[model samples]
Target: MKEEIKKHLENAITSYHHYYASGKLAAYIPALLEANPKAIGACILDKEGHWYCAGDYEKRFTIQSISKIVTLALAIMDNGEESVFSKMGYEPTGDSFNSLVRMEINRVPKPYNPMINAGAIVVTSMIKGEDNNEKLERIIDFFKRLTSNEELSIDGKVYLSEKETGHRNRALAYYMKEVGILSLDVEDVLDLYFQQCSILVNCQDLAKIAMVFANDGVDINTGEELVPKYIARKIRTIMVTCGMYDASGSFAVRVGLPAKSGVGGGIIALSPKKLGIGLYGPALDDKGNSIVGMKVLEELSRKLDLSIF
Candidate 1:
């Protein structure tokens, strides 16, 4: 059965690889711009530890905004639910992940959710650490644990690139601070947020991390509960509603799973108790999601009947 599934995926990869050209690479971050827009990869990890992969799956890239999912989970685990959500809303913003228009228009101006840049910055500040370096170390360590990959680390070039070009993010942070939504030093929190986003990983690493989430926060292999069950449920709900930025609702109807996408052309999604999928494609649609990646997932979901809804 596993071999048949793998073969099906290989055939699907051949069909989807051609769609890469329709989307463009993320150009805002100079380092991310260097990625080969044509490259595509995917991997899946089943509940029993079976593995399947195809097309540049071994290639490494920065995780980008997908790291927000981890940081949000870590913040909730470290600071508890009430403290974190008090500063971040649970609803989707229905705007670009980095947009500041809503912040200015809303009366209270709390970031709609932790998945967006403004909200992510606030979530990073909730990490328990005396300094920026310490906070980053804590985040990195948590990622290593979730993926079971000690070698995972930030791409210095990408970090530097984002730090240099992330003016909008800086403005959001400053605005958040001014409105009292963020109490930490803007520079300190922004530094951590950029560093976290630049953490590099391959499709296999992402599949493993998604497996942990698929198992409801308990890593089946180690039998260790990484996140509280309740927290995992909340994370999954938010991913379904807001993980894909403004296009999340459409994605939910089509793919029907709790998933997240990153600007580095990576996506991690899961089907409860079934499998976890990781995909990468440098080309993006108008929504900043991996264009080829979404098509591939849609095909897989339809073939396997993996939709939760």
Candidate 2:
């Protein structure tokens, strides 16, 4: 069975490499522009702590918008899921990942939830911090604890590059501030938000992070509860409903795993007590998701019969 799963993973990566080359890399974030658009890697962790990998599985990539999931999980811990949702929401949004369409159509510019840029900025504002660095430290600490990797650190080049080119995100933050939905200073909040997105990790680290949710938020190595059971369940629900930006609904139907993606071509996906998958392919489809990443997950799900639906 181990050999079979290994072969399956290898086949998936081998068959899916071309899909990465066809898709474009995320260009809006200046730092993401530097990634090798052709690199495709995957890491899968099974229930028994076994690891299976293929392709460029060791390469590090920016967390990109995927940082929203960590911020949301922390918000749920700090403010409670009910309070967090009271301010945001859990429905699938049809707009682009960074789109501001609802602000013009609706009376309020506030976003539907924390997965989008607007909502992520608002959520970052709520995290208790003395300053931007401290807030970023808190987020990094959580990721490190979850991944059991003390080496986790921000890619400062990525952070500064994103900050330099993040006019749209800045606009979104300011608009939220205008409506009383955002309380923190816009620059400070954005600084924290962008820094979190700049956190660096490879497929191995992502797989460990996903396993926390897969096992209901307990650190599998230590058996310590990192998040409450209810909160963990809520995290998975949000991943399914909103994690892929606007493409979340289709992802739910096809991949059927609790997952999130970053524009840097990284995806973190998991099956509860079953498996955690991390795929990195620096090419993105129209929806800002990793194109080859999705293909690999779909094939794995089909062959492994893994689905949360």
Candidate 2: minimum summed lDDT over ten consecutive residues — where?
A: 101-110
Residue 211 alpha-carbon offset, candidate 1, angstroms: 0.9
lDDT of 2 by residue, 1-309 (tens): 688779989999998888876799778877788889889999998778899999999999988877787788898788876777766666667898777778657765568767888788888888877787787788999888888999998899999998999999988877778877887788888888888889999999999888888989888778999978888888888888989888888888998998999998999999998777888998899989999999999998888888878
How high is the CA lDDT of each candidate model?
0.91, 0.85
Tens digit of per-residue lDDT, candidate 1, span 1-309: 798668867887889898888998889998998999889999999989999999999999999999988999999988999999999799988899999988799888899899988899999999998898888899999999999999998999999999999999999999888889989889988889999999999999889888888889989788899988888888888999999999999999999999999999999999987898899998999999999999999988888888999
Estimate TM-scores for all models. 0.98, 0.97
Q: What is the lDDT of residue 303 in candidate 2?
A: 87
Q: What RMSD value applies to candidate 1?
A: 0.9
Residue 5 of model 1, lDDT score: 69
